[model samples]
Target: MMRKTLTYFLTLFLVIACSTVPITERKRVNIVDDAEILPASFAQYDTFLKENKLSTNKEKTQEIREIGQRISKSVDRFMRANGMIEEANQYKWEFNLVEDEQMNAWCLPGGKVVFYTGILPVCANEDGIAAVMGHEIAHAFAKHGQERMTSSYGQQLGGVAVALGTSGQDYETQVLWNSIYGISSQVGMLAYSRTHEKEADKLGMVFMIMAGYDPEESIDLWKRMKADSKGGAPPEFLSTHPSHDTRIADLQRYLPVARMNAREYGIDE
Candidate 1:
């Protein structure tokens, strides 16, 4: 009992210690870490790219790079203006378009991004791609990875408590701890993904405007996504993100703010 109690407090402390303190008030946006988390993330993203088939279309690949650079620059400007220049400097953004048909794209910590080729038709143009890129890149800015790690650490401590409370011997306790860590890590991944999607929706709008693309495009893109779904997503709450309906509606609500931000940047929306 004593051991479990102590473990819980320790884990709680780690979560607090590692959590990102937003530059403003009580977390208009929650953030995570790049400096502490990126090394592992980079290696993993690199390996995934190496193992997966890559797009051979020269022009298409070139286009992804160009768009990524333009959007990244815009995000840099916004960050600098907000006194987050130091945070922006931590990014070493790179874009790669892969030849997968999953209609998926993701950005890793420290600005490593990948686009699956299957979604090109959905993207449709430079502006369309900007919508997706802004959202994915926004995940990094929100520090979802660090948030996940911090949350996982807390869960891990809970597992340690279980092991300590129930396991009578050293070997049994060790086994229980390992199992706890494994299961909790998987759960943490799913929860963090939802947070990332929301973060992207917010920050990505900011990026698109800064990059000379209209943030309202995000609403149109999500509308297309729902049409592509043809129906509703099945239990996305358990897997990747919110339901398609939920995402599209949220986009609708935020479009006005995004549009207003673009006007501030002199990008006529």
Candidate 2:
């Protein structure tokens, strides 16, 4: 049973894994497509806006929109120039500032973005905002969320396989195997998530540079983020995110590469 299950999953993985991200070119499962996902994403975005308080500070709200627009335009231009016009066209960009104080922001697939006022202070100015927004947009642009969904699906399939393989085993043996499988699967997922975060950081820096923002601001932003954490975080290997130190160092190391890539787009900074 284990052999048969493994064979089946391997075949399925081979058949469906084809999509490659734009900048990173990382191979990913094509199990989910934009057409099938965008309607739901858009609906959820609308519902979220309806449920949340939109910021009343007109000046701040305008600034959020302006930063978002500039970053989105830069992304679109880069994608179009790189033979990804169809992918770029699929994005319907919308950015809003919410009144929450959670110091959080996210970009939903298909280019819907929400910035909490709480994070604005962390993103102190236009360049800082570019750093944050660029990172969020990078996650969407690289289709990391879609890849995560695919990975979750694969994990579920793995669980199912384990169940089938252990069906004939003793109760104690079954429990042990199941526990091991669950732990390994969780660890794999966490590793996958960390990789995605690192990829976003790199791509975000590139986008920010191309958008005419200083890539160095990325390091500064992460430093601010680390200070905000108050030195409290799980070890890097155990967390879904790299340690703040790791992120800062990575951004500092990659800033030069990002700037060099920007030159290709005629953005020499």
Candidate 3:
């Protein structure tokens, strides 16, 4: 049994050890799905919506869908022009409005999008809606989910490797895998999650601009977010996002470039 388990572990290790990001050059944001994570993501989103009461703000909720559709569709066009249409169509593309009084929004692995009722006050208008939607859509387009999954697989494989290396050992490997595998495979090692958050901020601004929201608004949004941070949030180092300072700076840096792209591809409103 040990031999069999060891063989299995070795095979898993081989797969993960060999897995790497082939596109060394940072490519334009796009998702490539292999495990059909999108469908599961869509299903999970549906379940959440069914269980939660959606907002009765008929006009506002309709506006969310309108803005989400516009941004999502525009993002698709942008991706296609950039040579990644395949990645954009991976989602079924549904937007929902939840009745919660929290300024929150997210897009799932697929195109499942949700806007919380409370956020409307902050989002303030269609452009603000577009800003938030652009950020969420950017997270999906960048394949953040797959990146996280690949990271996880690496750690599991690493733990199994350590176990196999240990001559006649089980407890140590199991404990180590549980404790460190997740940490070890992180892309940035010391501050991997921050890297992802920053990437999302950059790419999100690109999409917001492409979808007709002024990229400059993103800077203000981050400022608002920074103020919100003081109210309460997970510490900067521990969360998947970096500090608002980093996000604000990145958004500012990307504004000019995003505006140029928008000028080339999008219609002025």
Clashes by residue pair, model 2: none
Give the range of the ten consecutive residues with the poorest summed lDDT in model 1.
21-30
User: lDDT per model, in order?
Assistant: 0.74, 0.86, 0.69
Using TM-score as the measure, which candidate wins?
A: 2
lDDT of 3 by residue, 85-189 (tens): 776666677888999888899888877888888777766667667778887877676666666665555556566666665646678766776556556555344
TM-score of each: 0.78, 0.94, 0.77
State model 2's lDDT.
0.86
- Cα shift from native, residue 178, model 3 (Å): 8.0
- In Å, residue 105's CA in model 3 sits off its true spot by 1.1
- Residue 56 alpha-carbon offset, candidate 3, angstroms: 0.8
**Error of model 3, residue 190, in angstroms:** 8.9
